[model samples]
Target: MNTLNSNPVHGATRLNDWGLIRASGEDAAKFLNSQLTQDFALLGLNEARLAGFCSAKGRLQATMIGWKASEQEILLALPAEVLPGLLKRLTMFVLRAKCKLSDASGEWQLWGLTGTDAEQWLGDAAPQTRWSLGQKGEATVIRLPESGAQARFLMVQAKEAADPALNPLSPSDWQWLALQSGLAWVRAATHEQFVPQMLNLELLGGVSFKKGCYPGQEVVARSQYRGTLKRRTFLYELEGQALPGQEIFHSEDPGQPAGLVADVASKDGRSLILAETKIAALASGSLHLGSIEGPLLQPRPLPYALTEPE
Candidate 1:
């Protein structure tokens, strides 16, 4: 991890750039304002938003931590490897809207945080502290700092001459936090593979029931209202190594893959993993990995509760 500002950011890997793309123009807000599940219209100059970029059918493309840099400029911070395909898909919809989507990845960077040290650390070091979702920026870029007991943030390039703060925490710390958050970044292997709801986007605030129409809005809404959601994401802990995309098995069905590992973090020898699976497949007791004798997965309660269908 790249070290910047003496590693003031906790729960962050290297002080590195999270690929940020700016979609700016007269039609920008009008365009995206119509899309995305979150309310971009409510985002103030310094405020940041956590949103999902979904396919026209409503499956997730890539998740975003977006902010309004200016009235005409909005910045979306996302995974770099996933940016190219996302950009291409977003560009296809710009046929009529006067939006200009371009790669601003090299021009800016990102910083992540969690644990007790994140908030106070950034407050002490980063310039201008408009920390939460509606925080006003002082000619600088600050994504909404999560305003809770669990802390996180993404710092952007404030000016043309500005750059990322290099200080970073240990890679292990970052792994731990990502696992806790249950983030499932869209990789090539998993791209367009799982629906947003399957990744627990609804529970994570990545979906807005009150928001207007966007791609897949109907499907997302149906899943919530009808409650026929057979699959959902769950946080799991295992005694063995947790591999991303690795198949998890059940004692009842050894022939079918029950779920896939989304992300993992190692702490105290036992590893925590985020897995997407069928709700009926998981239970309180032991579940075999491959054979009925494989390591069992212990279920843990999420930080928040799932909203019941209305």
Candidate 2:
């Protein structure tokens, strides 16, 4: 495992790829808790939760970081490409629930911060632990898990109130760090392609096993207790660019695809990706990116331990 020195520094980057969905109304929390994979009804202001919206068959349609902005309002942050569709789908189910969902992407500015000086940049109180939430001026800062060499946080502020001192960090750098952290951010191309466990959502606290039934809850529970999971997400590095939804083929199984790329971050000449594949194929076959004849991918250790079915 790779380790970083405990020393922290100050760095900031604009996250243009992310957007927010604001859920506000009398029944916001109750409505979301009943629809998503996280426990939103009990989400406190001091914490954030990683959550997933899955299809009826248990395939993840979206993955997001959700936090309670107020007792009646919750904010969900996710990749911008899927925000519009997801927001629409979520609204369709609101029907008579005392909740209103809307796209708040233009109203909020999202930023990524790293180093010990992060709190100083936000000029607000910041959380002390991973996945914790803090208030900074008009911004909500949520500390993200440390990835590879740096501790990180995600800050969401009203666009008009965003600080100008926060320097822009490369989006690719942010993506690489996120990939290293082993948390998959589902994008449009990969939507409805993975179950929560296949993306290691459970390990990341994205799934609440004790929470009341949500979409695909039954399938998810059965997969957990029946020990029927055969595929899981893994991290890998390759020497070229790759996109989400790209197929991976094992050398031994040339006629069949072994996996699909979940997410990818490329910098300079190399790319790092999260791929969901058969556990058995990972153990015995040589995986190639794109196709059986594509570039070979070297498997890298995930930051967290995977709980395989017994």
Candidate 3:
């Protein structure tokens, strides 16, 4: 298996290394369950989940990859750059909660596996934390049920035993999977610019409609139930750093910005970008960037349908 390594936790696909926050205390699950879009309290022992922390007005503030280490504790994996703001925001609501949140990325290692089968991954005898993959696999493979998408992203504590023989994926492999799947991850440029649904979070299980109140719940619910959303994320190919949130325009409407690049990456000589755009702009193949007037923003298939009009 192709691989890349990080000194903090050597010899594995240190895929997208990010900051980890360990939330602990009697009210940990309860507090987070009420805050994030996912029901963290019901998270299985060997499972990791994607959740969003949004503003009270139903705008996304942060996106998280979390796993419950115990009934009273959960490890929240989020971008290091986005951590400080998240902690401060979370602490603001700590008026009467029984939870303590701390930066914990230093003590753990995360990995991703690809170009190999799940059976082979299970055979590698590493006393690793078996994360749930849901309907995507053995609750270990990250899979999208409605979309039938399957992939594996795993984590290991730095102190734990990790064997290189497991044949993990290279960082690029993890990236390619995301690009191919047509998923757009928020980056520094696109930070705090989108609500969860704008990036198709509900389709990816990153948003929970049935969950109790949390930041941005009202707007998220409204967008889903009433289909009042004005924009949505899309996949497009270009060249160069796909500057997250960069504008995509068309020659016909050069005066007005058409779309924004949500994520960008260097693939071969071309760049693949996830852009959020209006349905009207995308219907026509007139999207352009720079002087390339006719460079069409070809729409790629997403894993799930956008929640539609009521």
lDDT of model 1, residue 206: 66
Q: List the candidates' TM-scores in order.
A: 0.81, 0.94, 0.82
Q: Report the C-alpha displacement of residue 289, candidate 1, in angstroms.
A: 4.7
lDDT of 1 by residue, 158-180 (tens): 43543333355776666555556
- Can you give the lDDT of residue 23 in candidate 2? 97
Per-candidate clashes, comma-separated: 10, 3, 11
RMSD of candidates 1 onward, in order: 5.3, 2.5, 5.9
Q: Tell me how candidate 1 scores on lDDT.
A: 0.64
Ranking of all predicted structures according to TM-score, beginning with the best and ending with the worst? 2, 3, 1
For residues 36-84, could you state the per-residue lDDT of candidate 2 as single tens digits? 9999988888999999998899888899999988899999999999898
TM-score of 3: 0.82
Question: Which candidate leads the pack in TM-score?
Answer: 2
Which prediction has more favorable lDDT, 1 or 2? 2
Model 2 clashing-pair count: 3
- Regions more than 4 Å wrong, model 1: 1-12, 15-17, 115-117, 124-149, 158-167, 266-270, 288-295
